[model samples]
Target: MITFSKDFLWGAAASAPQTEGAALVDGKSPTVWDKWFELEPELFYEGVGPEQTSNTYYQYKEDVALMKKMALNSYRTSISWARILPDGRAVNVKAVQFYRDYFQEMKSNGIEPIINLFHFDMPWWLMEKGGWETRESIEAFAFYAQVVFEQFGDIIKKWTTFNEPLVHVECGYLGEAHYPKVVDFTRAIQVGYHTLLAHAMAVNRYKNSKYNDGEIGIILNLSPVYPKSTHVEDKKAAHITDLIYIRSFLDTVVHGYFPEELIQLFKTHQLLPKVEEEDKEIFQRNIVDFLGVNYYQPLRVQRPKKEQFPAQFPSAFASHYDWPNKKINPYRGWEIYPEGIYDLGMRLKNEYKNISWYVSENGMGVSEEERFLDESGVVQDSYRIDFLKEHLIMLQKAISEGSNCFGYHMWTFVDCWSWLNAYKNRYGFYRIDLENQFKRSEKASSLWLKQVIVENGFPMTDERKG
Candidate 1:
């Protein structure tokens, strides 16, 4: 009953820093993660750093073959800015050849490549120049994006300027989780504004480039905001939360402007970032062709009861609300709300001109997955299969009801290193045995997904029988 369209993109996504283990190899310079690990090795989980990842740089051919075996129509991954442009200004020919072969291998294996220009990894040299906080960094990013389009634009038809831009703004500037950790609300807004500007610049560049035949988009980690109750203050807080987290990037890229309410709030609080006279026009002129949404959980908020530690933080307007008895991923501690996908889809359809979108990343991460390995060495992860089915069923319903969603890509194809968490959690169709020479074996969920891809969708009432 829950069948997707014939041309639906059934795929998976991973980032360069997480998958490519050759962190310092072949003209690849240091990224923020590299420096952060160097500065504080004790911070990362189990002291595991970016150097010990899935080794996709060396094993991309085998990875692409696995994608073919799984019948994937697409695979989304980021081009390491540091790897491709070692110093953020010069192109690395070695990195270019590696990506060329990697992407070509995917195409040869019948998989379409969806390439993202930047994920959380910023070239350390760029960070030294103030990263996204300065206008210079924005221009640098535009130049880097241009080089990427020129290099791989023929092979990579689907492009994303950045993935989860808000994460860097919040995690890096507003919180201590990421590099250049500084608790500065004013700097956070600047970083976010500059990043959006860079995206607009990249979109404009791509539009006027010789490789203008393909589409360009930005990937957002969207989480629907829910008020704890129908109280006026709670509703107001929820709306503010939505404006901050979702609409900040979503509205700007799709509607070519930021939310006026968000602007007013920032102005009232004196948290506004400096802007150029031409920036407004620049944003109004450039809009994305499509959207790639990465949804893992929804945000529940209530009116703040008291002043938060960081008085200027977004949490001052709305505090987190723990929904009682909500189903959760124990390992990740994230609420499992499949219906959020339906709600998000409906919002896009009704508000955002029915923009074409796809689920760029969705998967369950479990810690200590080796405990689930059977005698045959396969990770018997039915939990992940159920998670995929439940989410996809909701997505299918949304599409059936006139949502313009075109595809669904899980979080990753193989288990890769997560920043900070490192390898504490595993989220992949192919389990990577770090101890056994990083051998990859398909999990039960992957087998189920292969059948779903083959059928274009899975049955709602019936199970995938052996």
Candidate 2:
């Protein structure tokens, strides 16, 4: 049997900006998403924006009830910075009460809440003030963290400073798929540096605050890098990709320092962000207590095909390679590699002091899932069940071999809006009917997961063991 610890957390994760529909209600200000959509509605998928999501702000009670129905012991969600501090100045009393009541509901339902302070939803005012590119913006974020910790720290014991800070840097600054759409490498590095500094500052605040009993962490979307071939050039390309994408943030948050190679490389390229003298001390002193890993796919890279790609950032050193025999999620185009989970676990155990962590986000996203709905109106998503089971088998093997993994939380509980893609891909245990009155229904995977949670694992059949 593939067994997990009795205390293992079994749940799902969602974010306020993705799940909450009241974008403009109760003194909430616009996030960068709202502003971006307003500026260029055509850029988003089918005119869908962040304005109307799953409507969890009002239906949080129903959402909690659904979580209980799925037998979830824990649930991870983010507090919208814009919702709480709409103007980026003072507290919004109504927003505070709303979150307090929502969290209290989760606690009452036997659900442990893992709350994240930021999830790429920068308040428009803060973004206008230069976002994370400026030290002033970093300071504002730390202050906002202090405020959130002060208000809800007593209820939510598990906290995450940011969800996928790298995505914020890459998508917004480098890729132009997200808001502000700047493709400058220098600005991207600065934004990434300041964001990490913000995380460290928040960790410092939470550790020193009265809520020290609670554990604090950061969610990183870590992809294990692989070389395209055994050639020295390919290996070198993979190592550089690992340093830039993985170690840059992972090392600093866990080991209290940046990778020396990364620093030197950035310095050589004149891409280093401005650093204050006291920042190093703060980072060393405020290392995260735990980590939340959002693993979707591994990276495969080879030596740069040309001297300089259009991006001229990491592409200058490495080029992405499509593995010949890789399985893929056709709907989303992400490589589906279950073994990568095991690889990540072993890497953490061996190199990172065996830090306590959890699978904060892992799930299969399918496009137009309604095509698979059964006659009873439920989504018969057996593909998701198979996906989860395959990943769990690998995860169980990792834990058996001594990885300090504590839990598994899927990408989301209900279908929620994804940035730019909007609802193009559905990744949820409960299918939210956008065409209807935002009604939610269960998928086959939710039922399968409920049983797995009840048993603390699944039976290891011959096929699974193989």
Candidate 3:
């Protein structure tokens, strides 16, 4: 049988832009996502943008009620930078009131509010001023973090500096998925560097204020890197890939320095970001109190059989291969390897000295899920239940083996808009009926999860086979 600790946290996470639809209303300015969708509507599926999201701003009460039904004791939500700091500098009073009310409601429902400061929603105004590329903009972010901590200090305690820093830097700078899609590795390195500094500054402020006995940390999406073959070159490729993608941010805020080989690789290619002497001290002083890990899938890499095309980033230097005949999420095109979570957990325990951590984001995203709706208007998403069950079992195995993990938050609470992908992939426990004024219906997985949370865990025979 699989069981979790009585203190284990069971929750779901959602970001503001993906859930809150009042994008420009109530004194809220534009986030980078808001502006990006305006400029490149074609980039998003079905031309849907942040403004037409799950309308969480207005529907949060109903959502929280549903969360209570699911027995979610801890819920993670990001505070939009644009909503709080409309112009990137001046404070937005109305936005502050909204968040205060939001936090109050969550507390009223007995749900722990785990607030994240940034979740890729950089204000459009700041992006115009070079965004994370400049230290001045980094200071702007730090000030914004101070504003949030000061305002909601009494209600919220678990504060995350940023959600998925690598995703922000990689997708927005090197890849074409996110806003300001500049294909420059040098710029990516710069953004990545400043993001770590911003996190450090925020952590410093969080500790200095000591608000509500708060614990501050950053959420990172980590995946174990694997070599496709037993060849030496392939193993080397995987090692380098892991350093660039995982350790670049992990080692910096955790250890106050970049991985030697990662920095050397950047220096070898002259891709180092401009850094000031004061950054060293800042990085050293503001280590995280805990870690929030968002693990979805692992990366399998191989050495290039032929000379790869000239690339500007380390990720592009290596070729990737899917596991031979492995199970996969057919809808989202991602390989399903539940044991990878165990691998990541062990790595943190061994290498990171067993820092306290939690599974912040882990769930399956399925497209066109409406087809699974039964005649009774409920989605029999038993598949989603299986996905969660398999993953949770692995998480339990790690915890029993001495990993300092205490929480498990699925990817989302309700069906919310995803970036670039928009509403194509549904990861919510409650299926949002777009045709019926966004009416929420609980899928089978939600009911199962509610029971799992209620019982702290479920027996091994509980998961029904498809």
Candidate 4:
């Protein structure tokens, strides 16, 4: 009974660094990820770095043809800042041509391109200059954004400013899992504020440009926070977690302000982010045109009973995150709550006036790809199909209840490199044989997705089983 509109965009998402090879070719400088791999390859899972991934950079024309076979009407890919601008200061002409050709090919193949400006791949030069912590890097990011808008604006209309800013803040700044390895909360907050400011500045710049029909927005990994227990302390902890994790960026981007709870929390902990009065007006004046919600999992939180961490713990949001023992997906080490998508959709509807939105990224990652394959190279990924079905059912329910979700684009198009996990956790509908020259084979989920897209709804048991 669940039916999507015929015009609903159905495609996959990817980033340049993950899908594109030729990392240093055509005047491209090294990104932080490349530098991180060079510094310590041991940090990544299975010792896989971002050298040559799915090789989409060279094979994009063939890849677009494959997308046509898959019946995708839209596709999402990021432009590498370092690829376009070797040092994040000057645009590389050859790199620009590569992207222009790539976008034009996608369009010629009847695919709408959703281009994101930044996606976790910071230029190494910028990282050396303090990355997001320094204002200079923020300015450089705005410049990069403006250059991309001016150059590719004619071909790409759907633009995402930044991909998963919270992940950038949490993983890089707080968790020490990503690059720059800062565990201090004060720096993390500052980085978050600067990222938001940069996004706003880029939005304003794009809005005033000649591409009047082009839309610019920010992509947030909005995981709804849930308390493990019904206790009042647990509830309060959940609220604070949501405030710091979700509302911190949501309030700034959607509502044009920071959450008062977050401000008070930072004040209480003596770890407030450095913000200027003038920057506040910049954010307030330039709200995004749309919101891209990347839902993967919900966060489980509980009250912290132990003493707070020392003030010098090198993360931005110090003494805040507390997690109680909860059920987790053993495959990916992430919580697997499906209802979180519904809760997030409702929250966005009630709080943000039902703004135009889309499920930008959502998928499950599996460590072992061989388990799903048969002798014929066919992968019966019923588990992945079930995962998508469950989440989409919840999404369909939300839509029926009046949530203004425009479309859904999964986390990836094909199995590509994850930042830290590298090639360990495969999350692609089309499997790429890494041992070979990255030959791709369509998995069972790819066909399932095609049917879903073509039919514009969930297939019945008889139709799906076939």
Lowest-sum lDDT 10-residue window in model 4: 313-322
Write one digit per residue (lDDT tens) for candidate 1, span 1-466: 7788899999999999999989899999999999999999999999999999998988888888889999998999999999988977778999999999999999888889999999999999989988898789988888988999999988889999999999999999999999899888989999999999999999999988878899999999998899999999999999989999999999999999999998988888888889999999989999999999999999999999776543488878899999996899999999999999999999999999999999999989999998988999888898998899899999988999999998999988999899999989999999998885358998898899989888777778756531
In model 2, the Cα lDDT at residue 302 comes to: 96
Q: State every prediction's TM-score relative to the real structure.
A: 0.98, 0.98, 0.97, 0.95
Candidate 1: give the clashing pairs.
none
Model 3: residues >4 Å from true position, as ranges? 210-212, 305-311, 464-466
Cα RMSD for predicted model 2: 2.0
lDDT of each: 0.91, 0.91, 0.88, 0.83
- Name the regions of candidate 1 deviating beyond 4 angstroms: 307-311
Cα lDDT of model 3 by residue, 255-317, tens digit: 778888987877777788899999989999998988999999999999865653344656555
Candidate 4 local lDDT, 1-466, one digit each (tens): 6678778888889899999978788888999999899999998887888985999888898889989999999998899999998976778999888899999999999999999998999999888889999888767888888899889899999999999998888889887888888787789888988899899988888888877587888899998877767888778777877788888888888889888877777787887877777987898998878898999887776666554643444222213343554445578888666788898889888999898888999998887888878888977888778778878888887888888888888878889988888888888888888786458888888888888887788744424631
lDDT tens digits by residue: candidate 2, 1-466: 8889889999999999999988889999999998998999998899999986999988999989999998999999999999899887789999999999999999999999999999999999988989888889878988999999999989989999999999999998998887789998999999999999999999988987877798999999999999999999999999989999999999999999999999888877778888999999988998988999999999999999887533357798899999999999999899999999999999999999999999999989999898988888888888888899899999999999999999999998999999999999999999998886368999888888888888788886623210
Error of 2 at 115 (Å): 0.3
Of 1 and 4, the candidate ahead on TM-score is 1
For candidate 3, give the lDDT: 0.88
**Could you tell me which 10 consecutive residues in candidate 2 have the lowest summed lDDT?**
457-466
As a whole number from 0 to 100, the lDDT of residue 231 in candidate 4 is 82
TM-score, candidate 3, is 0.97
> By summed lDDT, which 10 consecutive residues of candidate 1 come out lowest?
457-466
Clashing pairs in 3: none
